[model samples]
Target chain A: MNFVHTMETFVEGKKKILLILLAVFLIALPYMLNSQYLVTVAVKIGSYTLLALGLNVLTGYTGLVSLGHAGFVAIGAYTSSLCAVKLGMNFFASMILGMVVAGLAGVLLGLPTMRVTGTYLSIITLGFGEIIKMIAMNWSSVTNGTLGVKNIPRPSIFGYDLTIANNGLYYLMLVLVLITTLFCIAVVKSKTGRAFQAIRADELASTMMGINITSYKILSFVISACICALGGALYASLIGYIDPNTFNFDVSTLILSIVILGGMGTIRGMFVGAAILIAFPEVSRFLMEYRFVLYGVILVLMMRFRPQGIMGWKSTMPYRLSKNVKEQVEKMDKNAPLNLLNETKG
Target chain B: MAEKEVLLKVDNITKRFGGIVAVDHVSCTVRKGEVVSIIGPNGAGKTTVFNMLTGVYEVDEGEIIFNGNPIHNKDPKEIVAAGISRTFQNIRLFSDLRVIENVLIGAHIKTKYNFFQSVFRTKKFREEEDKKTAEAIQLLKSIGLDYRRDDYASNLPYGEQRKLEITRAIATGAQLILLDEPAAGMNPQESAELMEFINKLKDQGYTILMIEHDMSVVMNVSDRIYVIDHGKPIAEGLPEEIANNPKVIEAYLGGVQNDAEDQ
Candidate 1:
């Protein structure tokens, strides 16, 4: 009993130890170096990671080729920032509001697109994204007509203001990334997750088996939109500003490229894609103008040669055992001393 | 036997595809616990009748009522939901999915899960999913493919694929099953096995509707047979009666051939 307890504690400790180290390093980072430029770039990477993760859910799991993800992000940032600054709403409240609005927009896009697929679906979604970006740029009363939302307030926790400078915004972005990743992992293993995979595998056959493919695909779009919107709101808050030019069709294309690069329909691949693409631009500062061109080249090569991406679609994770094996493991764990730890964990 | 209760009624159903009338005023009834066959020459509208009954294509000018509810215009999924299921002529399994997953998908008609509950793996959802997989396995076991449950569906051989397709339809909790040429490509021995297997399926409380061109299979397993000629049911009754019907003989052997031979 004591041995099992020690093993459980050791396994649990190793996972959180890194998180604790990350938090401590962040708190001490600015004081040690006081590098404003590094902090700004790091925060930006975190924000973009959130956006890529959102796009991954669609392009990855459901095989939905979306070129309109950045549109949802733009809507989120503009709606939430305008609400907080113009309507006197709290930052968190407006974030939720932005998510709902973006999600509704996703449904509108997904509903008419229920029958469209492959190249046609992509063209339609791209048009939807472009139209939203145009609306954001031209709408004067709500979005300030190309000036973008400005002077958005920083979120305060327990009377402490976390600003974009000095890694305060960097930590906030990291926390949001963590939350979103966990939520996505949970969702991908659920029944709806299987449905998305089923639809991706085959739709006509899926319908014959009584799967409601339309509902599941729309749900994928909705969740993808919500994730993008949440990231957009957080990005606006962290940067303390927004602009139409910042999130456009190009951003949507870049995010989608990350999904393909990471291997669509995979959670771990999302992180790999996010890490590489988010850091790619800043890392290649010397050739900044050609970075996007290089990105396109690499993406095309990968898709042409290694279409499965880094992790591959089929999971090698021992934890992703079949349901029957999983049940057997749970049964054994229950009888063994591991039940106490298992019950509290998953 | 004819004593079994009638479960599905197809009345004067006519289906036209552009310029051609595929099924012209076809009428039939599927009795509870009986295996019925629709046998005819190619393009005789046998498969078309199966399609209409299973809600794949709508009847242009007739009604298909299942358990006394009009089901001709209903979506195939809704019809499956109403306790009916089917298999296609060319195997239409989800090729990339596992064998068990294919069967489990068919059981979706009886599965209970709201979207959010399934997405979050709530208690009820997990319970229902576990129950479904078990049922799927049991169905697979009956078809003798339980050991290969985790294998990809496309990897299964032609005969095994046909068996799996039937197993999947059985898992749908369907009282009536429509099979379009279930043994189209099987060898004689495999066809014999299919005939026995289908009879067993009927014994297990499934009302079977199938279209088969193989006369041996048609006569061996079918309790009743419907023969169509130029998109109309020219003869329908027991296998013996259908075989002896002058119209059925004319349709299969041709009256013109008989006249020319006599001259």
Candidate 2:
């Protein structure tokens, strides 16, 4: 027992050192890259990371697959921009408005939670995204139609304008992304987060455990949509333009792919996955046209080799029973453990 | 026993699943602190009755009264919140979660922290969390699973998984716990332990409703026994009286022959 305690502390110490090194790296990256294009790419990665983190809560933690997240993003971007342009709201208030609108859209879309899941749920979300896109395309009076909303003013904080080229914009996004990341981490460790995982683990069992299935399922969708909306509002501000085409099905698929590839239900994995996928096409322009093909191949290989993804708990940790229980498990027939685990997981 | 107050009253509740009656006019009463066993052959709809009691399946006829209040057509979660919880015939644990986490999920009803409080980790959240953890550990200790609290519930041996499911059910602060065929796959030794555990729960003042095929367990642990066949109660009496009842014997003999032919 004493030896195990010491070993745990050793591992804890190593993790702390590693975290400090990671913090140094993240703080230095933008300043180290002298090129403006590189910094912009970094900004895009930061925003996409935020987006993937949101999807992670729904898909990774709650096990609710959505194929229409871009609809929420579109809602966020347009709502924020329109609030500023038409309603004369400040940038900060517009962003909050965007989150609220997207959150409501999320709850609205979540109405099918009681009736569907897995592929059916995915299809429903996909249809919702396409419908949102059509509305954005046709609603010329408010959205300005397919021509897109142009010249979105940059966010101003305390009389300081965070323009496109300014480091202030990058720092602002970085801070918001960090906040979102921390907020998600907090959620995943809380009782509510455990309820989400419980529901994901088994909805029937969760309901039996006194978790309201409808409320928790909708809560997951609302939180995911709100986070995605925040990211969209930031993306619109960073790029200074918005279009219905920008928040398309392809973008939604990319975000979902990032979650799966990086490691579903893993915080650190989301950042790594988003950074790699977002930076890949930028560095290798020649392979840009075949990016979708590359993603497909990678996904197939991953499914074949590591269905749990890069940082999944099952991949990183060995299957283990308690020391006393291990003896009991060993005495059981060869296939009992696998069958029990599979039957319970199902 | 004569002075005991009735805690749960199942008033002729009937449940039909698409043209077939699963639980037909099943009426049973549980006193405040007693171990009641419901025994039947396969397809006797013992589990269906448990499902209705826990609100998993809505009663199609009549009403369920718990603590003198009508509880039919209520949601399953709400039923649990109202002091009833259950385990499945086949264990339905949150496989990926740690054992302690499973019990913590059961404690959801007692904890008062909301989403914002949890996210911000307010003082109330911390206090409730600490209190819940302590309570869960105590529950696990009673079931002899405290040492394995950190392990995934799926990793426990089959019998321990069954025990954990019981521990989780009790952790919900349930006054009435419905255990369905808890000894289905247990060895004789594990079944003995489960019998002891049921007795322990009764000693702790919990009202337990169990469906058991293990006659030794049912006869030794149950204060009262209700015998059913084909969704209807055939007999209800004390364990000694149930052991001598002619109709109960006929039902068992008929089931024993069916079991022999299937084998």
Candidate 3:
């Protein structure tokens, strides 16, 4: 425990430097690899990371497991794709539109399922994912029937088209991932985040704390859906083609697996999880179909042993005290009764 | 002293669960700056009364007036906004969060910032967050749990967890605090300390409504005691009067001679 504590402090102290180095590495990754396939894989990881991070808010922080997150992704991809194709809309504008639509869908889903919890909620989400796919498959005029929205114009900024070969898409993914991470960090650190964790810890206790569990739960769903839709918008553009099959139950399972494998409720875990899970099958093609079997075994073993996931270990460092709070503590120490002062010193 | 202003008036509230009436027409009034206790034997609907008051359960009938407004049947969040907060009998601290975070969550209702402000880290968000954090830390200090503020709430010992729960309730800016069995599983020494701690709160002018099984703490700390049995109010009076009330004794010890005669 002592050794672990020291190690954690060491990591905490050098955190900023480490983060800078990581940022530098991610920026130079495509150049260093010089492989389009590798860049594509990196982009995939980025997309999955965004999805997992979004799902983390609901499942990890708020304790609401959603299996139909892919539905939000589908909504984003289709809405953005359809807008770009039929209306000749700009990529960013359409993407925002897609996100808004998905958020509305989240509100719709959250309201009806507010009274349900645990496995029941998961089932509803699972059905939602299927329903979305069914709509995409059957809704011919808008979705173009399973042939899918093809020839999706690549996203561009300042007249430069983003493609996997040019690494524009990769950088765009990186920026979105960073923004989502920052958003997640901000949400987790604030009063809203505390309420989310409180609800997850104990619904009864959270309600007693005057937290409007209904509104907060709905808010969580909205945030999660928006993030997932962002990822979906990115995916549709990256692949330059999107079909109903692209966002199936399997994709939802993969995103959830990334969350569970990376460590739920930790932002850093999503990056690691997405990197390993997305890159694993590519590198381990030698294992053939057996790679999937290995994947199941690994997840099961993780559950049996480190159920908290790789990065889910609770930090040993003291909870961060804000600058103002630190000053207050100092003032309090000075003004404390003599006996209390003596007790604190001792 | 002049008659104390009533902070809470629970008038003839009834709650029924199917065929069972959990709390039957229970009525009580809590005055400002007083430590009022509801004492009852096990399964006497003490917790049900607490749940109804806190809006965890809607009253089947009657009303709960708080600060001269009928607050019964309102959402728990609105009820808390009206200045009532409570701790659980089972000590429902947010185990995963740090101690200070748990207390900060109690101050959630008091935070004025919106979701956008929190997301954007706006000036208002920062100011309110820093203020609440400092206040929470100060509260922890008062309870001597400041050093453990960074620790996960579940890591605290049982007594400290109970103290933390009360501190969390107090942080909610509540004018009236409800404690559901605050001394359920404490040793004599711990109960004594709790009695002192409750007295300290009363001295701070916070009205307290508690359901306590520990007679010593209840008798010593409460300005008045209300006794119940089988979901029915048996007696209400000063602690000394309650200790002498034949009906209170009968409710607690179960009418010994009457049972003997029946046998």
lDDT of 2 by residue, A1-346 (tens): 3554565467566988877887888777777886788888888898899899989999999999999999988998999998877776788899999999999999999889989988999999999999999999999998999999998888888878986466777787788888998899879877888889999998888888889888889999999999999989988888888999999999899899889888898887888888878988887688867976886787899878977776564322222333544444334342221112112211
The best-first sequence of candidates by lDDT reads 3, 2, 1
Ranking by TM-score: 3, 2, 1
For candidate 1, the chain B TM-score comes to 0.93
Candidate 3: where are CA atoms >4 Å away? A1-4, A333-346, B257-263
Q: Between 1 and 3, whose DockQ is larger?
A: 3
Model 3 is docked with a DockQ of 0.49
Name the regions of candidate 2 deviating beyond 4 angstroms: A1-11, A86-88, A288-292, A314-346, B255-263
Best by DockQ: 3
Highest lDDT among the candidates is held by which one? 3
Kindly list the per-residue Cα lDDT of model 2 for residues B1-263, writing each as its tens digit: 37699988888888898998878888999998899999988999999898888777878998989988888889998898888889989999998888888988887767778999888878887777766665566566656787787888888999899999988888777888899998998999999999988887787688999999999999999989998888888999999998877777777785554443442
Interface Cα RMSD in Å, per prediction? 10.3, 10.6, 5.8
TM-score of 3: 0.96
Off by over 4 Å in 1: A1-46, A164-168, A316-346, B187-193, B240-263
